[model samples]
Target: MEALGTTSLGERSPWQDLPSELLGLVLQRVPSHAGRVRLRAVCRPWRDGARLQPPLPPLLPLLLQRDGTFLSLPDGTVHRIPVPDGVSCLMSTGTGSMLFLGHGDGRCSLLNPFCRDTTTPQYVDADCFGFQIPSGDPIVHNVRKVVIMSDHIITIQKTFEGYNCALSIRRRGQSTTTVDVRWMPHVAAYSFDAELFQEKLHIILSTHVGTIDLYVMDLIKDDNVSLQCILSTPVDNLFLPFGHIVDRYLVSSGDQLLLVKQDICKLYNKLMSAQFEVFEATDLSNGHAQWRKVDTLMGRALFLSAGCSMSLPASDRYAGAREDCIYFLCELGCYGIRKENLSFGIYDLRKGTLLSLPSETMVAQQGPQIASWLFPSNT
Candidate 1:
């Protein structure tokens, strides 16, 4: 009989010695963030091969602290990542391989974490800017969010003057997404927030009248991708169109579009303190959808910020994460960006209550919200 992990000839099993190319191919199929963790634990060769994979898919979201430490979720794992000097992770690019990083010289570059040297960076050909960054353009100064998706890149920029804003959706290869601009008479006046749902790009546009509209860009449609309005504030019957609305986030939950409304409770230091309300879309099949207040998120949890938001299922592995809760950051402005001063909290949907991060967890994080939320590509 053949011995364990051995052939009839008594040779050692070759399972540990797979080819690099084949390993890379296998790694591509591993979509779950948690699944990757188990994949690396198989053996030394497997771990090494997984690490050597060209572009590491973003693992479960981590809070990037001010001092280059990573605070992982659910497990409360504290990791000190060796980030290079003068380079700071600016935000997630919606992909695991590259991120938008900021330098000391007011310059920003695209950083691929899997690359050999974190010290050096070059320009990424995102090409939506059409102009060099740091060029003193008012538009560049107020750039709010830049999300890189599979088909196109979405850039949202807001200027303080009259709350002016613009949404530029550009395809990767020198073209632009066909947006339905007939409704938007003036791009500068309309302020909006966007997210991806069901393989489509969705956005929430807030107008001066206090009304908000939800629109979706159907990329998978025919040859021409077009934007279509799905719902508006009046139809939702939930949002009252408050002028005090400062930030609204669109989080795509499992087959659900969740809206997180943040209203200004207090204005201090040119920033407004946040108060939140959750709403879930209803009857989406007919295009004209309505919204209803969502008291719970089932077993899923949400991570949100001014610029980004993500939803994930709470599992046993993430012991620190609470189910049906929303996790967010607040600017305490006490220690001037110290991790301790950046107040983090988990809001319980069931009880409509909030619980702050424990003292130990806060201390592990550095004070920074550069990358608003790190969403997994698989999601």
Candidate 2:
């Protein structure tokens, strides 16, 4: 038997030195955010061509903190994402693309996480004045929510004033998606809160009365989307309109359709008729028709946030404290709710378990509610 030749020289590369593409694939599966961060710093070619990749499919939901940062809960674990330049907004639409609106510009941009491809519609200006009036009068504020589905249907709703536009989602690498509004009268006073339920896109609108009008559109549907009346409020006098501008009119908590209405008359009489009814969506698939009155958060309340209970188990209760949970930029920020004085306050629903970051650390976050869809394990 011939003896195998032994090489005295230094050995060559093992595993035949993987291809550049294969090396990148192996590095990408490292599973650590830091590992990916390090991989980006390895080489310029790697960073640009291999490391900084587009987001994967089945986009994950993320919440943007007040500090202009995005938070993601991976497997119930929190992960902070680095913001790239030119990114004005970091709203995770749960559509595999984060919504980025330009600064002081009418154009809104959608960035794909997987492809790193961006689509910008310069003419697409969304009005966002919201559903809050300073003197408690409902007026048109030009605020609107525009949703673009994967299948290319755009549904928009103007806040408070009820202006709505249903336009065809413009094909990428194309020009105008605008319709000939000159021939038709514009529908005014349309309000909608959008969510993805049962693998379908559901836009919930409200009527003159408290009944909910659900527009169910399959992301894959090319036919005309239909609007169906789903549920009506139990109380006659109660109009489950959009909560104050601060409250998230968009399907509160990603699931429940929140309607915050108070009996101002009852507050004046100092009676207990101050009811903030919460209707739980029974079935979001069939056009949000089935609803049940859940519970009333008893008190003269203001804003709500999905937060953890600092002590005991961190429950997903609304975070601000009544005395200490002050709303910044509102009424001089002293009278709203102070985060420090919440320890022994009565009207505060924190139950002495409210978790708070330092007030100095927390700048003002806009909107009526602050929410985080942490992984189920985190909650």
Candidate 3:
């Protein structure tokens, strides 16, 4: 009948006396996923506490390069992880995972590097999508860009004939549906980027005359999938000269859809500067939508690149992450010169200030290295 911490018990362990809530707080303060994993290994109670309160959004984004190096943000600590065999290059990144293209046969797989888990390799046939590249040709080497949504995959390729885009939609217990669209010289229906919103695919199209258009497609429909133009706007004058280097990113934020247009410029195979503009979709009552220019993200931070486009709240839990800003990693190519390089920066929408990341912490490489933001996985 003695109390828990009475003299009969002598001296209790410090960790045992610590409250669970306080232990959880301590675990939450550890930013790196590996750090949290080590903390959980200390004891059963610590593991339980770590599992109960996983790091929330605004968690520091990790920069994963094609060479299997993970550069942690805010602090810029570098860690090397083994790349899965046969992964030649990075294609796209999803929630807590990334899609990579195989070096041998152009097969793709979804890999969660933190947990070292991967999905079965699946071949993405370009001929099935639209363009008929030779059987021996590597699809990843030919495709200009690849995007992966929940169950859909989109690829844009430049063939000898012209540029074309293909959309493949696959649902559980259903066969995949593929759609191919060719870019016409005078038409403005070419897709630049695509994202899923409310289960429907939204595509961003560009014209030769600097016009930007948004088209929505219904993938669930049984019949042919046709794109309906929702919004059309013109690019600003400043972005006109860099049209060849322009890339569009479509991101979904809650009930709203965001379009990020970025232009990266290079000088002598090195990064020069980058610019961005964000727009939010509104209206949509009578088969029509309007895109309004927005300067602020309202406490949300966007990480954008050719590999992925994602948004998370810039919460206070993540130090050095500012709200209403964008963290960008993109490749800048100089037309005709055939030179390009990667660039990284943080752009504050409110003050219109662009700041470079600390160069000393960046990974030193001889050539351009592909970078994508990898979010922490619960697994």
Each prediction's number of clashing residue pairs:
4, 23, 0
lDDT against the true structure, each candidate = 0.57, 0.34, 0.60
TM-scores of the models, in the given order?
A: 0.65, 0.44, 0.79
Which residue pairs in model 3 clash with each other?
Answer: none
Candidate achieving the largest lDDT: 3
Model 2 alpha-carbon drift over 4 Å, by segment: 1-97, 102-105, 112-146, 153-155, 159-174, 180-191, 218-223, 234-280, 283-289, 293-354, 357-360, 363-379
Cα lDDT of model 3 by residue, 130-176, tens digit: 43324544322444455555555555554444453434433322234
Models ranked on lDDT: 3, 1, 2
- The TM-score of candidate 3 is 0.79
Model 1, global lDDT = 0.57
Give the alpha carbon lDDT tens digit for every residue of 1-379 in model 1. Answer: 1234466786777986888888776665554455566666666777777777787433346665545554555445555545446552355554323455544344445544433354224433323432123443311344455666775666666554566566665554433324322123153344567787777778787766556777877655434556777786742333544433345778888878998876543333112244568899887777658888988887888877545677777642423356887777543331124433444566777886666653334434443434344443422
What is candidate 2's lDDT per residue for 188-215, written digit by digit as tens? Answer: 3233455555456555554444444445
Q: After superposition, how far is residue 374 of candidate 3 from its true place, in Å?
A: 1.9
lDDT of 1 at 145: 59
Taking all chains together, the TM-score of candidate 2 against the true structure is: 0.44
Candidate 1 residues lying further than 4 Å off, grouped into runs, are 1-42, 45-60, 66-69, 74-89, 94-98, 102-109, 112-127, 130-140, 173-191, 219-225, 234-246, 264-275, 316-320, 330-343, 358-371, 375-379
